[model samples]
Target: MARAGGKWRNAWRKSQKSNLKLRHTQFDAALHNWLLVEDRKQQRRQKYRSLPHSIIHSFSAISPRDVIVFCARKKHDDVAAMLFLQHGEVATYHVGWSSAHGRQTNAHYALLKHAADHFVRCGVTRLDLGTVDTENAPGLARFKIGSGARVRPLGGTWLRIPGL
Candidate 1:
């Protein structure tokens, strides 16, 4: 009877594993479909507009030294914008995206590519893509990953002495 019970336990575990795998597959498919739909919508929007070149130029002019404006063209407008802060000679700090579009024509990728190319030309070795939260923002994480940026943990300060 003990041997029979052990066999039954193993069978149950196998079934559970299969079920988990199926669920994961279904979730992945759903997410992919959602991303596709979103991309299509964004493309349609982009067809009606042009990027605001003057705005970007103005931003660049007003920004302080060591800061550069990063902008991306969209279907109907210029969607994503950010600033890169030059720290000394080697590293560039990403200040975060200020204006982001909701579509998927890979505009963000183009912007990053342009920035990376410009940095390379200017003798900048490293481009910081900013900190990202992976657990709750998986889609954003995926987008960042698609930009060819590696993920790394960022350290933060802790309030150890009750604000002293």
Candidate 2:
């Protein structure tokens, strides 16, 4: 029975590995083109809400070296934003969206999928989504979950003793 169980476990592991459908892509020149396209769309929707050009410039500067951009499309329109820590371990610091569109299009989903793939390819075993507010950021939590990330509470900060 133990031998049979071992075989079953091995089979399950192999099946899971085979079923893993993560698409990982490296940052390249094509990303610049994609960003331009996304930026143009944001510009067109300036009447509703306009993201500052500085933000795009900053993203462009950082994305090539220490960040990855994950994007999703809605009706051929892409909407997404993210900045991840590229060294040490994979982690996301600030992630936000325009809220102008792509909410119903699941652009966030595609962004997360790409992020996960990117991290895994970079040999990162974990991707920290940072802290959650629970109330104000429920959608953020849901998006992380849909990306197949396990939610775990972060450890509280340490307090240093006065003369220790």
Candidate 3:
């Protein structure tokens, strides 16, 4: 029954994983942790610091009551964060960034685990994990897949300017 045993082990492992989605201890802490991760990894740091960060300001603005911030901490220091936004039946996997230390600690796995745990309870029937660059971001693509996220080309993103 090696096959059966393997299946059982997998199930057990899945159950042991922590769901960090919307698992923020405090709004401020979550935001702080997010900034730390982004800063350490240079993940969209400039873009965030300028426009999005200014408009969003606080985590409350983006998540309100429907958002979950999952963070991984070490030695009382924030290392990584995964922010999610829920809309109706869809849970959009927003931005996730991690520090160098966080990566060594496999913080993203924890973040993804947490997201899967609480999505259904939050009225999120489907999870939209956004998109990844297969060529430039192969590791990220694999990470998503490893966490049970299937890839599907939802569509392309477009922007328009009112004044041309």
lDDT (C-alpha, whole model) for all candidates: 0.46, 0.51, 0.59
How does candidate 1 fare on TM-score?
0.48
Per-residue lDDT of 1-164 in model 3, one digit per residue for the tens?
13223433454354335232224642354545546446445645433232244323354576676656677777677667776667789877776777776666566666665676677666677888777667767776766655565667766668898996
Rank the models by lDDT, top first.
3, 2, 1
Stretches of candidate 3 exceeding 4 Å from the true structure: 1-41, 44-51, 54-59, 157-164
- 2 or 3, which is superior by lDDT? 3
The candidate scoring highest on TM-score is 3
Model 2, 63-123: lDDT tens digits are 6455555544443444545545465666554434534554534444445556766777778
User: 1 or 2, which is superior by TM-score?
Assistant: 2
Residue 153 deviation, candidate 1, in Å?
A: 2.9
Candidate 3 backbone overlaps, count: 5
Span of ten consecutive residues with least summed lDDT in model 2: 15-24
What shift in Å separates residue 105 of candidate 1 from its native position after superposition?
A: 2.2
| Cα lDDT of model 1 by residue, 5-54, tens digit | 34334433443332111100111223233333433454456442223334
RMSD of 3: 6.0
Evaluated against the true structure, the overall lDDT of model 3 is 0.59
Badly placed stretches (over 4 Å) of model 1 are 1-63, 74-76, 90-102, 157-164
Candidates sorted on TM-score, descending: 3, 2, 1
- After the best TM-score superposition of candidate 2, give how far the Cα of residue 126 lies from its true spot, in angstroms: 1.1
